[model samples]
Target: MEELLEKLLQAVEFGKVDFKSPYPPQLKGENGAYELTIKALESGVGPQQILENALVPAMDRVGKKFSENKIFVPQMLMSAKAMGASMLQLKPFFTSGEIKTKGTFIIGTVKGDLHDIGKNLVAMMVEGAGWTVIDLGVDVPSARYIEAVNNNPGAIVALSALLTTTMVNMGEIVSDIKANLPTTKVFIGGAPVNNDYCQKIGADFYAPDPQGVVEHLSKLAS
Candidate 1:
C-alpha cells in the first residue's frame, strides 16, 4: 500500500500525467498519476487515504519547491495537471460523500482584470491541496463575490488582480466581503498587492505566491 501511494506521489510531483505522457524523460512509459490512482482505488485503498497520504503530500513538495525557486510556473502547472489527473479519479468520492475536502475556496480576478493565468494557477494549486474551488473567472465584480460567499457559508474568498489599476477592485471586493460577509476570510494576491495593501484593505491574508496561499489555507484547516 505504501509503495503504491508513493508512486502516485512521485507521479504528481514529477508532472507525470499518465503512461502515455512523455514529458519527463526519466519517468517515460511508467504508470502516471491517473493510472496509479485508479489502481489504488481498485485495490480497495480508501479514497481519503489516497488523497491525504499521497496527493496532499506531493503538492506540498511542489509548493515548497516553487517557494524556494527550484521550480517556476510552468513546472508547477504541469504538476498541477498531474495532480488534477489523479483528482479526476477521486472526484466521484467527494460527490458521493465517501471522502471530504478541507473546505471550499472561492477565487477570481477582480473586476477589470482580464488576466487569469495567476488566478488559475492559484486555483489549481489550492484545489490539488484538497479544497473545493469555485472559480469566478476574470473580470468578476464585487457583487458576484458577495453572492458566492453568501451562498457558500464558511467558504474562504481569494481575490487576485494582475494590474495596478485593477488592484483597486480587489480592495473593493475585500471591503464588500468584509462588510457583508463579516465571518468569511478574505485573501488577496497579485504582483501589485503587498502585505501593506492587504492590511490596508482589511483582508485576512496576503500570499505572494501559490505556495503561500496553500500554506495559509493549511493553517486554517488545522
Candidate 2:
C-alpha cells in the first residue's frame, strides 16, 4: 500500500495522468496517478492518505521545482493536469464529507485581466494539496469577489493579474473583500504582481509561484 502511494506521487510529480497520457514519454504505458489513486482507495487506503501523502507532497515538489526555475509552465501544467485527473476520483469523497480538505480557496483573475492560465494553475495546486478550490474564472470584478467571500465565509481569496495595467484592480478587489468580510485572507499572484504591490494593497499574502501559495495555505491549515 505504501508502494502504491509512492507510485501515485511519482505519477503526479512527473505529470502522468493515466496509461493513455503520453506527455512524459518515459512514463508511457504505465499506470498513472488517476489509476493509482483509485486503486489505493479500493485497497482500503484512506482518501486523506492519498491526498496528504501522495498528492500534496507531489504538488509541493513540483511547485518548488517551478520556483527554482528547474521547470517551466508546460511541465507545471502537465503536473496540474495529472493532479486534476486523480482529483476526479476523490471529489465525491470530499463532497460526502468522507474526505476532509484543509480549507476552501476561492480564486480568479481580476477584472480586465482576462487571463486564466496562472489562476488555473494555482487552483489546481491548491486543490491537489487537499483544499477545496472554487475558481471564479477570468475577468472577475470586485463585486464578484465579495459575493464569493460572503458565500464561503472564512475562505481564502486569491487574485491573479497578468497585465501591468490590470493589476490595479487587485487593490480594489482586496479592499472590497476586506470591507465585506474582514476576516477573509486575500492572496495575490500573477506575472506583474509583486510583494510590494501586495503590501500596498493590504493583501495578506503574495506568492510569486503556486508553491509559495500552497505553503501559506498549508500553514494556515496546520
Candidate 3:
C-alpha cells in the first residue's frame, strides 16, 4: 500500500495522467494517477488514506514549487490535471460519506474580469486539499456570489481579477457580501491584487498565487 501510494504521489506530482499521457517525457508509459489510484482502492487502501497521504502532499509540493517560481503555469496546470484524475476515482467515496471534506469553498472571477486561469487553479488546488469547491466561473457578479453563499452556507468566498478595472469591482462585491452575510469570509487574488488592495476592498485574505489560498484554507481547517 505504501509503494502504491508513493507511486500515485509521484505520478500526480510529475503530471502523469495515465499510461497514455506523455507530457512528462521521463514518466511516459508508467501507470499514472488515474490507474494507480484505482489500483490502490482495489487493493483495499482506504479513500481517506489516498487523499491525505498522496493527493494532499502531492499538491502541497506542487504548490510550494509554484510559489517558489520553480514551476510555471503549464507545469502547475498539468499537475492539477493529474490530481483531478485521481480525484475522479475517489469521488464515489466522497459522495458516500466515507471520505469527508474539510469545508466548502466558493470561488470565481469578478465581473468584467473574464479571466479564469488563476481562479481555476485556486479552485483545483483547494478541491485537491479536501474541500468542496463551488466554482462560479468567470465574469461573476455580486449576486452570483451572494446566491452561492446563500446556497452553501458557511462557505469561504474567493474572488480573482486580472485587470485593474475589473478588480475594482471586488470592493463592491465584498461590501455586498458582507452586508448580506457578515459572517462570510472573502478571499481575493490576481495580478493586480495585493495585500493593501485586499484590505482596502474589505476582503479577509489576498494570495498572490493559488498555493497561498490552499495554505490559508489549511490553516482555517486546522
Total clashes for model 2: 0
Q: Which residue pairs show backbone clashes in model 1? A: none
Best by lDDT: 3
Q: Compared with the true structure, what per-residue lDDT tens digits does model 3 show for residues 100-206?
A: 88999999999998889888888988987878999999999999999999999999999999998998999999999999999999999999989999999899999
Residue-level lDDT of model 2, residues 83-180, one tens digit each, is 88888999898889888888889999999988998788889778877788899999999988888878888889999999999999899999888887
Give stretches of model 1 more than 4 Å off: none
lDDT of 1 by residue, 66-88 (tens): 88989877888888889989989
Model 2 segments more than 4 A misplaced = none
Off by over 4 Å in 3: none
Question: Over the full model, what C-alpha lDDT does candidate 1 score relative to the true structure?
Answer: 0.91
Q: Alpha-carbon error at 135 in model 1, in Å?
A: 1.1
How well does candidate 1 score on lDDT at residue 11? 95
TM-score for candidate 1: 0.95
C-alpha lDDT score of every prediction, in listed order = 0.91, 0.89, 0.92
- lDDT, candidate 3, equals 0.92
